[model samples]
Target: MQNPSPTGISKTVIWLMSIISGLVVANNYYNQPLLGLISKDLNVTESAAGKISVLTQLGYAFGLLMIVPLGDKFLRKKLILIDLILVTLSLLWMTFATELWMLYATSLLIGATSVIPQLFVPITAELSSETQKSANIGLVVSGLLMGILLSRFVGGIVGEMWGWRSMYGIAAALMLLIWFIVYKMLPEIQPNFKGTYFELMNSVIKLAKTQPVLQLSSFRGAMGFGSLCALFTTLVFHIERPPFEAGASVAGSFGLAGAVGALAAAKVGGLQKKMSINRIILYSILILISSWGFSYFAGDTYWGLIVGVILIDLGVQSNHIMNQTNYFLLKTNAVNRLNTVYMVSYFIGGSLGTYLASVAWKYAEWKGVCVVGLSMGLAALLAHILFADKIYKKQLNQ
Candidate 1:
């Protein structure tokens, strides 16, 4: 049997994984633009529709904590295949759901199984040469990020023309094709854990408590992601009302505006090589907070939203790549565990942002949502000022 190593990992395999990661991670966001349609179809209020997103984030968080560590203990290839199948089922469930509770159930299931992309990320890291590792990881991560940035756009257009249920139906069919590609293209990894399953879980907890770099990175990443979640979750609701009175497709156009920034930030590995990671993260938080200023000043103008979307995507994507790379490079032997901790915090922040943004949208409209995004940005800035430098240096010395 061939031992697991970086050799023989072709560019074909890398691109395949990158594309799959993008397509799969989009499951979490497709509902954002569909919320209004779902609300009317299911006879639920806007607030109730908002809970679907919150539950999906919660489910994704739960899966990261519980399922990702298994990557270190089992074959990652098998895990990815299984998750793809499960997500397909969840998508169909969403397509045919008649009650609010059924929609909630399918939302959670899709979020949990859509964690397929996280499994692929570590494999790409393992398969790259030392010199090219950063670029390779960035390629795959950018695919995932683009899927996130673009899902709302696609969902909005599909929902506007074919109805929201059609979007899920289409995703379900695409997933069946994705399953075949992964079975043919993915490579196997030998298990590295030498303990019982219970011990494996314990080690993840211990690592969370012990790793200071992981702590700092997770905190800052969460805050930035929370702000991003706040904007998109409430965006369709804002754009579809008031002077605009536009449809879902128009609301989702922001995702494209956001993607322009995401595409630029895709070259983030170069940015890290030039500047200190701490300074990059600091600048990122400042950018997120400042983007909100445009949202504040532009008022009822679409130009403000367009500028804000670009800057928010730039800042948050930069913050995320920095944080993920920071903890990811810390422990080669336990990459999955490290990812588990980082991602769990990341999604919890998203869940909180979605919940709070929904509340802000419900009570105070656009202004309230802006306050939440700016508040998270300020908190991220404070996290960088207080702990980022000191903990980074302390980890370096040891």
Candidate 2:
């Protein structure tokens, strides 16, 4: 049965939504901080460790295409609950994997099931009025961003104390708790589209080709995510070696600093009211460039690295929020399809970042990783500046 709309979005619902979104999204990142530990324990190399990041992202892309669209065609509450249960089992399975292949398979499953948060974000946006959309998006995005940043930190600590296996166990238990809360609090949201899965999938593909904003946002988001991924992927490797020999916990602490950057974007809801999104992207690009430049000299001390992470994430998160907000403003009816296009590209870029980080680390170490990050930031900046006027006109007309 469809649940009645509340007098307003309840605080209970908002709190539950944030927690559920944060934890579900955290699934994609559990393998990151543990990459080092998993490599050593599994008797694998850094290159092999890259698969965890790549496969998880590939799995997320697959889910975005095949799973997220279901939100537009089915009851969101049921889908969220089912996926949560599946993810719980997947995390539990991850804890039991003794072989690399086993871990890879479980990671893929976890990613596939973690699309629940994406489903929720779209639902929240759909539920809110235009006046409240930006704030609503920000609140939910805070959850998504927190999950991305905090997973590594939590995973690192859990991995250090109870071992890598324990980290998955912790995730599984948390999933169950989230499931209980969601079941109790979340309302059923009927699908907006009553089309067959195949028809919906076709529409998604069509949007990818026909929608310029989706294409552009996807491209820009992917590059930004790729750069971000490269920096993080290599960071684990860097901290585990050389002058600043640090453990998993120390490596994880950097995520907290990254979280600070995401928090800075809380003001984005306000900024969007006054400025054009193109202006937002332009400013974000400038910040990204400066952040990467900081990384060049920030290598020697943890504090310097913290500052670099903060700036870089601040740039990445604000631009992402702006891109998403702009894309959704396209055809309100096209939100899911546009999001599918945007996120598929975003994850693809993330996969590439993971792969390149491992490869670059092999040849040039931390310096190579930084170069990759810096180049991506610079290229994205130039491309956006070159095309800014056109993209802005296109979006405004849409």
Candidate 3:
């Protein structure tokens, strides 16, 4: 039987969802700040170690394509629990990984199972009233953004104090605790689709082809995220050189600045009541361009890097929230599949950005990285300016 619509969602449930979202998404980012440390310990070059970040993101893209669609075909709460178990196991694997290949393989698993946040996003949208939809998603995404930022902060601090492997061990323990909490507290959300897994996956592509807004939003989001990844992936290499010569902890501490932007971006969802999504997209793209401009000029100054990081995150996260809100509103029953299409594209872009940044760092160091980021921002801006007005008019008429 089809489950009855959720009558209401409590603050406690929202908070729980937010925390779970934060924790699950953190699995993808914990390796960013720790990359340098991992490289040193594993006796790999910094450039070689950056591939771990790329592979992890690629794995996430793969999981979004493969596992997230299952959220529609299976019971969501049970599916989430099973994935959390996989995440915990992956963290445990990372803790014991003594070789570079072992770490790479475990990182892929971590990224794949860390897709729990993707499941939670559509669920939050499904549970809320139309008026509260953006706000609730904003709250959940805020937790996600916090996880992304704080993962760097905590990973750096923990890795510094107890070594990188110890950091993974702690993450595994935390995942286990969250697992129990979720199993006990989360309500079972009945499956919306009754199709076979193959049909479910096929529907994802069909939805993307039929939905123009989804395509534009996905493209703009992909570019914004790609730029964001370009900066973060190469940031440690920048700080560890010349005037700064900082440690992993210092690199991770930049996330604090990013955290501020993330919190601010959460409110962007609430602005949907007041602003058009196209306007939000335009402003976000401008902010992204300006952010890379700041970084380009910041050079070795701590203040410039700090300000740039804040702007970059604010720009990217705001764009993300806007894109997601639009897609969620498109199809109530197919929200998870919609998310699968969008998020899979998003992370694939991120993987490419990280890989390009690594290559850029090898060539022109910080300058090359900045150039790559700025170019991506400009490309997104151009696409938005060209296509967004027509799309917005169509959406309004519909």
What value of lDDT does candidate 1 attain over all alpha carbons?
0.86
lDDT string for model 2 (343-385, tens) is 8888888888788878888999988888888888887787787
The true-versus-predicted C-alpha distance at residue 121 of model 3, in Å, is 0.5
What does candidate 3's lDDT look like per residue over 1-398, in tens digits?
Answer: 22324565666788898988998898899899999999999899998899999989999999999999998899988898898888999999999999999988998999988999899888888888888888989999999999999999998899999998888898899899998888888877889899888899889999889898899889988889999999988888888898999988999999999999999999997676677888987898899999987899986799999999999999999999999998888855998999999999899889988989999999999989999999889988998999889887887798
lDDT of residue 9 for candidate 1: 53
Tell me the TM-score of model 2: 0.96
The residue-level lDDT of candidate 3 at 289 comes to: 90
Please give, for residues 1-398, the per-residue lDDT of candidate 1 as tens digits. 22335453567777787788889988899999989888888888989998999999999998898888899999988888888889999999999988899989999999988888788777767666766667777778888988997889999999999999999998999899999988877778887898988999999999989988898888888989999999999888888788788888988878999998788777877877788878888887888898999887784789999999999999998888878777777756888888889899999999999988999988898899999999999988998899987987787788
Best by TM-score: 3
Cα-based TM-score, every candidate: 0.97, 0.96, 0.97
Task: Give lDDT per model, in order.
Answer: 0.86, 0.82, 0.89
- Give candidate 3's whole-model lDDT: 0.89
